[model samples]
Target: MIVITAPTGNIGRHLLPLLLESAPAHGEELRVVVRDPARLPDAVRARVEVVTGSHGDAGVVDRAFEGADAVFWLVPPDATLAPDDAYLGFTRPAAKALAVHGVGHVVAVSALGRGTPVADRAGLVTASLAMDDLLAGTGAAYRALASPSFFENLLEEADSIRENGVFTDVVDGDRRAPLVAVADLAAVAAGLLLDRSWTGTDSVPVLGPQDLSPHDLARIMTEQFGRPVHYARQPLDELYTTLVGHGLHEAFVQGIVDMKRAKDEGLDAGATRTPDTATPTTFAQWCARTLKPAVLS
Candidate 1:
């Protein structure tokens, strides 16, 4: 049996079908822990066993992990919570459940920067790494899908890009960093969850075809949309102020500010792309295929 959490999320939504399609050949039964079973597509609900409750709840995860062999773990972000509570606190229950259930393997969505200089101070990245440590301590063969900034993150600004031909971030406009598509990340996770050949704990960096800065993204956006798109670097203080104004906790807001600072300092700059690390999608390809459609819609 294979278990999945956050099945309605960006990566989970894409991953469900792939796992279901491959289940026959792999001889795996799929289960998911969802806050709302109704959010699951009718097809998915019909195929997989569902434990209806927040995965962070100990009772929910304990029930979901029963007789499960492999699990896909993802902590849904909550900006109103502290960094520790959002990452480690939420993961502790699942960690305990994994050990208790003796699950064979675990695949988790994490961030890159484990060995970087700024990793200790990288806020969310730091917390994610710590979460991995907690899971690794459980003795389940764990693979942390270490990804950089996701291409899907741009969708959050699709409307602004469509209206003003601009997108904003706190990172330096010219600092190139790895950007990956969530679909590629999900595909990789599905492949890992199905096969039990691998053992031990490791971080698998899922990088895009190439590294590109915000400025480069803007150039690609301009070409793709046939309009002059631009990149705007928001001041860190201003970004923090805005996040706070939106009712985010100060600790959570600071964590984001620190993460952006780390990125600007080249936190995700160390990973060298290889056949294994490099995924197939490129910024230009994603922009044309995904972002354009999102903007148009």
Candidate 2:
């Protein structure tokens, strides 16, 4: 059986078809770990056995990872102060469960630039590095797929674009950071599950499409949408207050601002390892293909 965590998330949702097609024959099982089985979509619920419980619970993970050959691991996103600290509290238990269960292979979803000091302020990278290290010690064939910041980040601005004719982020409207599609990340994770050649702890970077700045994103939006798209750049505190007003914590806002600072300092910019094999859909293409239509309606 192949078990996956966060199966209702962006990449997990997109990964379903490929996984179903690739499962081993003679009733190779595909199971998902979810806090509540009833919340899963009908299609995913019908296709796989839903392992009910939080990934954080050892008791839940013991059952979730039981009989599982490979596992796709991910922690829930946190928008709080010292996210990395919070993650250790969350991921440590799950890591123990996987170790106890003797899961054969693990494909963890991590972010790029995990270990650098600059990553300390960036929530996902800091937390994921800890996760990678802990999981590595488990002796399972572990692969920490470190993907670039996702194109899905654009979704957070969907409401602003639809209502105010603009989009906003901490990014300096013109600086480029490698941004990838979740589908690409999922494909790489699935490939690792199928091909268990690598051993110990390893990382696969998924930098999809090329680097793009908010200005470039705006231009793409203008072109694809056939409307004058604009950028809204806010001061760090302003952004923090705005997000806090939306129910996120100030610490979470600070982490986001710190990420933009990291971007400004060239933290996210990196040398590409290989020409990407995954569908390298540009932001414009993604808009034309997915986002534009959804928002227009």
Top lDDT prediction, candidate number:
1
Which ten residues in a row are the worst by lDDT in model 1? 35-44
lDDT of 2 by residue, 1-297 (tens): 888888878888777667888876435689998887886778768889887888877788888888788898888776654565556777777778777888889998876775555777665466667778888888688888877678778877787887887987666887887888788788888778776777877777787767788898888899888888799887777876777888876666666677667766666665464674334767777888777976676
Clashes per candidate (backbone, < 3 Å): 0, 0
**Colliding pairs, model 1:** none
Query: What TM-score does each of the candidates earn?
Result: 0.98, 0.91
lDDT of 1 by residue, 7-60 (tens): 999999999999999987988999999988999989889999999999999999
Q: Candidate 2, clashing residue pairs? A: none
Kindly give the stretch of ten consecutive residues in candidate 2 with the minimal lDDT sum.
270-279
List residue ranges in candidate 2 displaced over 4 A.
25-27, 80-82, 115-117, 271-273, 276-279
